[model samples]
Target: MRSDTLDERSAVKLLLWLLLFVLCWPLALLALLLWPVVWLLSLPFRLIGISVEAVFALLRAVLFLPARLLGHKDA
Candidate 1:
């Protein structure tokens, strides 16, 4: 079900890009060409974001450990 939503979103994005291509081929071509370089440049930032998220999760779990031990349920 989630995959279907993602596919639909991809389809919509593609359609929007096609419309851009039809309106201004040069800009669309430039975007298509630069997208890979942009994604590659952003990869490290994405990794950092994931690492930060994991750290926050660990902190949350550690903080909640005493409550959990006392038979408190997570809300």
Candidate 2:
């Protein structure tokens, strides 16, 4: 016997995807910002475009630097 509504399954899938996205988001942001994407994207920041995802992007910049520097220059 199986029991699960389509809506309930969709909700569970959404939650799983959100968790996966969050776990993988730093890597995504790192790729975006380390490349030309941030410059292209951030241009709007000074003007009239800001978003929650942008906030996450900013946080990724801070988090990535220290580990990156340490890797480059060993203490």
Candidate topping TM-score: 1
Q: Report RMSD (Å) for each prediction in the order shown.
A: 1.1, 18.1
Q: Per-residue CA lDDT of candidate 1, range 1-75, in tens? A: 699999999999999999999999999999999999999999999999999999999999999999999999867
Candidate 2, residues 1-75, lDDT tens digits: the string is 235687788899778666756889876556545668667777877665457678889998788889888785435
Runs with alpha carbons beyond 4 Å of true place in candidate 1: none
- Per-prediction TM-score to the true structure, in the order listed: 0.93, 0.29
lDDT of 2 at 19: 76
Full-model lDDT for every candidate: 0.98, 0.72
Each model's total of backbone clashes: 0, 0
Q: Which pairs of residues clash in candidate 2, taking residues 3 or more apart in a chain or in different chains?
A: none
Deviation from native of the Cα of residue 32 in model 1, angstroms: 0.5
